[model samples]
Target: MTVIVVLAMIFALLALRLFSVLGRRTGHEQQQIPAPADDRPAGARMPAGEQQDGRTPAQRAAESAVAVPAQAGLRALIAADRSFDVAQFLSGARAAYGMILEAFWKGDRETLKSLCDADVYAAFDAAITERESAGLTLDNKLVRIDTANIVDARVDDGVAHVAVHFEADLSAVTRDSSGAVVAGSLDDAVSTIETWTFSRDLRSRDPNWQLTETDEG
Candidate 1:
């Protein structure tokens, strides 16, 4: 009976020691879990699809364009086309603006036809014809685009339209058929503000947007 009691006491001590070591191990493991990393910064509102700066990638894309007024329309566009990128679209718009201006100045109706809608193309074609009839040619250059911002956007009847306000410096000169400058000078750059609306059919397979309307801003 004494031997049995001694063996039982030894077993109890072993169990207590094992439990003590396990408790220490658990506390040590807890310390390894990073605290500050799991905790969000104070007063930060992190909505879904937003980053630490509190804006989504789409919003950031429109930052150069000041997108507050066009946010609702932009949202509608994004909802319709999941692959649409605002930044990429803005970049493309800038390029198109330059190309269209150059084409119109040089009377390249082919390029204008591809970039503009029927009505827009007709207007440019008429202007080009008039210039050719008058024996006048435009030697215009797009100096630089100062600003390009999406002022409005919407999707209607499966069509998406975005209006962009553009401020640019252009060097324009009109020359006679004999290669003599008739008006304007390349030394002076003219600052012009214009609004161009681009449209695309969401239901169509073609991803290109055409200039649908234009106005002076």
Candidate 2:
């Protein structure tokens, strides 16, 4: 009878120890799991209000790179590269749009070469060459960028590509060799919508993105 009582107490102590160990392990596992999905990447620092609720800086920038509800591609991109930020990207894209357009219009091959990939630069070069052959010059100006939004984003094979939809007003003028206006009017700014895709190698240390593709939105 005493042996049976002793065995029962021993089993109770072992069960209590097992339960305590399991509880501690479960809590540790939960801590290892990350918080819910957040659009903001890990590296960049933000102002006080910007980090609230895991919301991205895009929310404050008024242009969400992940789209309003977020897409699978954008999510995948964030997963692949934690440093990607839609807001900063959109800002840089706006500047690049203006710079690339002005360079193409001015026949600034050096600028285009630096900002564009090989294919895009080649296309721009061809157009510039054709224009020069025809003895024409362009005086184009980017009036203002009304909106630039990220429409799509993806990471594939360690390369990241992001598509931005831009709406802007531009004034373009074409002049003949004699410097007489031949085409387009600089007085009238025309609204244009275009989608441009930019790409960067995630593994590369360079943060700059190259213009890869362009199309009418």
> Best TM-score goes to which candidate?
1
List TM-score per model, in order.
0.74, 0.72
Choose the strongest candidate by lDDT.
1
Q: List the residue pairs that clash in candidate 1.
A: none
Colliding residue pairs in candidate 2 = none
**What lDDT score belongs to each candidate, Candidate 1 first?**
0.76, 0.72
Instruction: Give the Cα RMSD of candidate 2.
Output: 24.1
Model 2, span 132-176: residue lDDT tens: 999999989999999887787778899988888899999999999
lDDT of 1 by residue, 176-210 (tens): 99989999999999999999998988898766788
lDDT, model 1: 0.76
RMSD of each: 26.8, 24.1
